[model samples]
Target chain A: MPPTPRRGASAVLLPRLGSLVVLIAGWQAAAWFAGSRLLPGPAAVAAGIGEALVHGEMAMHLSATLARVAAAFALAMAFGTSLGYAMGRSDRFDRVADPWLVLLLNLPALVVIVLAYVWFGLTEAAAVGAVALNKIPNTVVVVREGARALDPGLDEVARAYRFGTWKRLRHVVLPQLGPYLAAAARSGLSLVWKIVLVVELLGRSNGVGFEIGTYFQLFDVRMILAYALAFVVIMLLVETLVLQPVERRAGRWRQRHA
Target chain B: MLELDIRRKEYRGVSSPLLAVRDLKLCLEAGRFGAVLGESGCGKSTALRILAGLDPDYEGEVRRPGEGRLGIVFQEPRLLPWRTVEQNVRLALPQPLEGRDLAPLFASLGLAEHRDRHPGELSLGLARRAALARAFAVEPDLLLLDEPFVSLDPATAGRLRGELADLVARSRATTLMVTHDEEEALALADTVFVLSPRPARLLGEVTLDRPRGARDAGWVAERRREIERLRAG
Candidate 1:
């Protein structure tokens, strides 16, 4: 039998809350020893968060960062899944594209951002494009593994049944690739989140990264912590509420049997 | 009707190319069921793959009814784990089928209650039944089975074999099954083709003149001995 909804929710929620309390207590202790100027207590950072929300442009900057992440995430996933599927399906393509994938995978995200800014001249397209570029190879590598792992037995089944392109793709290919897509989406999102901020810090004038950059210049540890906490909270929510749920649903069939 | 004449097939090994099948010929009259009985690793599957048009690298000629659909039950169930039993069967249909239309087929397979269940939730026996249901739903003119009842318990495999024979007779599809089980070959197939080991060659063919339902355990025992004798010779 399945766990009751309320019990299941608490089973997950209580441990998370416990961890948060422990983390805050440690931070508060550190702050009491180091003093507020060096490292602010949790309450000082909370005040900084409230001040940013009310008097500063926290909402605008946060939205800007999110938009970049969304655009880059979508772009990387779309292109990465297609390329990965192609490479996985064809040996010739995989051999041909392998070196390029290696090169891109090893290239640092910072270098890619700097190159994009230099090449595209500090435009929004360049910033988002660079973030996407940094992420695509990782997505491709992961999704290609998924495509490669597809059962040849299922392929024969599809052919024996004479399934047309669309039917075979929907019922056979896509379902097999679902887990890979989820894996790419999860890792791709996290990668994009980190790189988008770097792109903003280096080239773009408006975003959470730029705000963080400004706070870093003034050495306002509280505000930096505030912005960092807010973004971490958003990412945590996305992981728990969005990515985890999707991963669970994609593999729900396995769970029922297990 | 279905016909296969494979002159040669070779696989490239690390050291040298290996021959898999040579001069293998088989023909099944329309609506007739045939079985190819061979030892394991004797390229029975290679020949089946050639017939199924999955191994085009081989030198062969396969003839079937023009525009006729084909259905195959592989060694494994091979059902999409994410799809329900009904949905997997529906996906095999050339045209859409209503739930009510599929209910009887499900009931016939003793899968009426499992229509909404995913393949992962099924026992090995039930999953094989689902695979059989999917094959029949396509209304195929040519049916291929590759050790379809393999790896199941003896009792489960026996029952499924009986059900499969009945279904194939009802559908009247020209079926070619590859198996090592003498009992299965004798029980279901109208003609059984015995094959030699490696670079597979046809040893001999046995035709069961008796109707499938009328074949008794004694007849099967006699036939198994005859097949063994032929294989040895």
Candidate 2:
């Protein structure tokens, strides 16, 4: 191929146009072969999505699901970073926490969610807590390793200068751990959201996960596809608009520092 | 003055103690620069760690003056990868220094503009300079340096030595450095102590009465040969 399109023509516009063309072609073919009930043609699914939007059901569902994911992700970030930092800093802390981490990390997410629901009686707290608990162990493992890998020379220099705890954290610890934390956060968000969906499907009644289960029971394939499409689009939007920017900045830091 | 008395260190999985500095009593005078020169694994780095209060598990007693602080510069710049040059330098400073202290330190080390740049962005020379600034910023009573300029080009190392010597002279900080480089040991130190290999024992100490920054190439060269012979044996 001749050098791929440059700047204005190739970089921004072409890929999106190609994707649109492929999507439309796929939709028309599916609609023709599968008929509307088992697989709503693309146009029908789009119409169902519009209908869901106007009726406000999709918005309510999306907001509910998002609230659960956000709550769990926040909890994971706060607890994971602190616990990981502590474990990394002291061998005593590491020894005490290490076994518990292994236990939690190996346990199945479904088992925890089911147990949490049984214990807490299917409340929203149980749902969110399940997701948070599922994520913490994994995040802790990542952050701990990052912290452990810090250059001892940096710590010695910190001591020589007599840096206080807060200064050392800001200058030495945080920067060293930033990329690792970012990676943890990104991966955590993806995992926690999926886990939250499972939690909602099993125990909660108002989120996207609940809606998917509800539609599936009624054999409403169009509704199922609509909700699934909405989720995929939302995920793509978040990765592109949010997680990727942070990852890029951290990656640039790693390129220079590591 | 600071002193170390008969230090011994043993590592795991070794047949015997890895380093034994027998009767290693030495008093580094206040406001004087000294070098500990020996071959690799000669316990020189280990000695600097003891003086810096890093390795406290050893058997000997290390007595540093209580009034003045101690600053250490490692063989590596050891700047935190995630930190900017300014941040790395600031790591040792208790709090941000005001006017005279901050400005002079950065300018002296030629790191004024590169302050906001991270260690990843710096050249080997610049990183070492930042390390130098970090040491100076501590404003220590005693400065312990473990060949902090080992990776720099000759010109850069020479310039840094001059700047560091000047800084030590101005601050009147007692200094102890360990270096395998004979010329670096001769150029920067007022007193040089040579150590025997492995089970390190202090063989002899040479005192240089030359004024700071005044030693000519010939004088440094002559001392370098003597130290080289001492190390070679």
Candidate 3:
């Protein structure tokens, strides 16, 4: 109802840049008052990351964490999408499966990770399984909503024209589902990576999360910040480079038409 | 060739089971145009759906061409908005329409230039025509149009009707269209089957002996009066 000013790249960039500057300044001020060993500022953390990359084994830990995140993401998305679609399309299936879905969704991430380790006895499978189990419920809930919103009219058209399984899914079903899948992937990737960190910290011995846990025991905040920052940067890269492109491509039609 | 004999079709309702169609018999020989005429929500679409084989729960025996060669134009275009016009039509036939030229079909429907564009970019009339193109592209032995031109402006609907009439006549496909408009039924179909309200049964049949697209306003009015008199009796 009210006038909103026109926005360009600068409109978005300026506010975000301003906020980051303020955040960094506040962190630097806190580091100045606190001892550098306990509360390292941005420069010391950046130097710590450089030393780890050059002298220590940061890449191996980073790769391990990335691999775990990828595996858990793939597992969750594949299983969740199929389950969600089934639940969405059939009321009977949703009625039967909804309580389990609700229970899984509400179950704490920490509990799943701990139980998985307890049951599987501290292996790679347990770590990946725990992260996937935690992420699957969210993916199912999001994708089920996508499925429920599917166009029945198009479905009839597909049926009346006798679209074969492959052809119908590729052209009709998938195109309609693109946005939803993209949304699920974006959110699911973030959630899976976070849970992967928790899984790694709790069980695995060679990931960014494990490095952070080890540094925490020795009270080396600089190294802890270094590994966490490196991991966060890698995740940001994955989000921007991989997932954002997919989400953009998925929603390209709507933006172009709108 | 097509044949439909739906003894009864019912839908579950909140309070009671709602009857849709019963004792509705229809037959169309090869290269004929048939229409089911009824009031809005008078189980016309249910009958068409049964004929389309989308509604199999009905107690009926429907005989039509094999499923693969059937084409349907729903009330809405139902075009995948993400796909281009040409892709939508091309997808119906996995193998290309063997030795068939769709250039003329596209030209006749005025979709030639818009073939590479999405449905979202087109007007409703154009979208409907695109739907017609998709159906006709299959070179179907049987074509179904469910209230295809109902929601258009008179000019758009009229133009689309002419395009459809021309397309269907050229193809000589056994076409069955359902509509509430008697004018549309008379304009398109050779034999029109009038259906009664809920639990719709065939009330009567009016065979328009005149050739399609040749039955002008005057002839239509004359036949309409006769049909009205028949209904009154």
Question: lDDT per residue, candidate 1, A1-258, as tens digits?
Answer: 463345577887899899999999999999999875969999999998898889988988888998999999999999998999999999999999999999999999999999989988999999999999999999999889989999998888888877899998888888889888987888888889989889989988998899989999999888888998888788888888989988887787776777
Q: Number of the top candidate by DockQ?
A: 1
lDDT of 1 at A230: 86
lDDT of 1: 0.88
State the lDDT of candidate 3 residue by residue for A1-258, as single tens digits. Answer: 243456888987899889989998998899999866899998899999999999999999999999999999999999999999899999999999999999999999999999999999999999999999998888889889988998989898888777888888888878777878888898888888888888889989989889889998999999998898888889888988988897777666565466
Mark the regions of model 3 whose C-alpha exceeds 4 Å error after superposition.
A1-12, B66-68, B96-101
User: Which residue pairs does candidate 3 place in steric collision?
Assistant: none
Stretches of candidate 2 off by over 4 Å are A1-13, A20-24, A87-99, A252-258, B14-17, B66-68, B96-101, B213-233
lDDT of 2 by residue, B1-233 (tens): 77777566655445654544555667788778889887877778877887788777777888785455877788888887766777666656654352334767888888889888878778888888888787778777788889877878888888888888778878867888888877778877889999887777787788888875678988888777776676666
- Show where candidate 1 strays beyond 4 Å: A1-7, B96-100, B216-233
The clash count of every prediction, one per candidate, is 0, 1, 0
Best by lDDT: 1
Instruction: Considering chain A alone, report the TM-score of candidate 2 relative to the true chain A.
Output: 0.86
TM-score attained by chain A of model 1: 0.94
Least well predicted 10-residue stretch by lDDT in candidate 3 chain A: A1-10
Error of 1 at B190 (Å): 1.6
Worst 10 residues of 2 chain A by lDDT: A1-10
In terms of DockQ, which candidate is stronger, 2 or 3? 3
